[model samples]
Target: MQNDTPLYQLDPTNRFTHRTQDYDAYRPTYPSAAIDAILEDITPQTVADIGAGTGISSRLLADRNLKVWAVEPNAAMRATGSKQPNITAWEGTAEQTGLADNSMDLVTSFQAFHWFKHNDALPELQRILKPNGRLAVVWNNRDRTDEFTKRYGQVLQSVSSKPVGLGRLSDATPIRQTNPYFTNLREISIPHQQALTLEALIGLANSRSYTPQQGAAKDLLHHRLAELHRAFANNAGIAYLQYQANIFLADPA
Candidate 1:
């Protein structure tokens, strides 16, 4: 892994605590086909969802009738997920999952892998995964090619005061190289989009890890958002947000 500071590491714990409501409200859920691709030949009985926040990914796995061991480090996020039935929510990080060795057939992380210390977590993943088990990393990335989306990104940067990392699929190369445990790394890109009102769009932005706006910054964020809404909002008063679900899968080396 590169030594560069990861955006997600900025404020690990409290970043999402305040926005948990909006997160569950506006954040896009992974597509069914995306999950289906990783879960090949494996029943619902053998799955471990590391960094399972708000049960978004965990509930999907559970819906497949598989028992889900939802491991999450954040207490607030874990509490949100605990309300779901049949989800075994554990307060644990990826590096120290507290799961038995070689017990899981599939170890999955959704929109959460980049937050982990991969060197410590990869070994834990290898320990929990059974022989020939699969490791899948899935992310729904924003498609900023659209004019409105591009402007929205600019608004985000202006408000957050953090460098918006690579905005293209090619920019994800470093993430693939972050760990050496997996071989046969393959990427599947699925075209996806979400239709959202201007308010929902702001909610989505607030839920991000790098959005540090508070007090005056928070007020300024809303001001900028209003300008974006006026500029981007169409006759229907809803903006079509485009995104691609990038699912990267590999097996133990």
Candidate 2:
């Protein structure tokens, strides 16, 4: 997917270092069904969670009592994730995870795969993973078909400092096929819902690296989000943000 599309010129590793608080607080969590699909037919005892920002995906595997090495290049993000139970956080990038060769049963990247240098990362993932190991990539795309979500997306688009195509929305199948390190790619989509209060919705928008962190644009983004929340939220003042959790699972080549 990245072959046909250009990515952001800025270093991906440093993008979220400043957004760590919102990222850990407001980003949507993966569904249990998605976890079931990732671990299906194989019981992974050891996992290397690449780009494991704040150990979001790492905690899922760890909760299953699996040993997880959450590899993240951002020191701030890694430090926060290191506090979680059943996880060993490593300060490393997807292209250069400091893990041994053929040592992991599974390697996963959630909401962070788009940042990887695809060519370099694929081989490293293969090197660290066992012969039958699986590499699962995941992204949660909001249901833009919904009117509120559509308007919400519009607000983000208005203030976004970078282009949207550079990130998670891109398809991973073509990207995987071009690389020899991973093959037999399979895709799964699970419905997910996030009930967010107004502040959380704003926090979620602020968590994105592409969105403006400070300026009049940031204020405008927040104002519009609040107005939309007023118009769309339920009686409980909670907005149900719908998402389709897209998952791509592939085996080592």
Model 2: clashing residue pairs?
Answer: 1-175
Give the alpha carbon lDDT tens digit for every residue of 22-118 in model 2: 9989999989999999999999999999989898889988989999999988888987743656799888888899899999999999987877777
Which stretches of candidate 2 lie above 4 Å from their native place?
A: 1-5, 164-168
Best by TM-score: 2
lDDT of 2 at 186: 79
RMSD of each: 3.1, 2.4
What TM-score against the true fold does each predicted structure earn?
0.87, 0.93
Task: State the weakest 10-residue window (summed lDDT) of model 2.
Answer: 1-10
- Tens-digit per-residue lDDT, 24-53, candidate 1: 778888878888888767653678899887
Score candidate 2 by TM-score against the native: 0.93
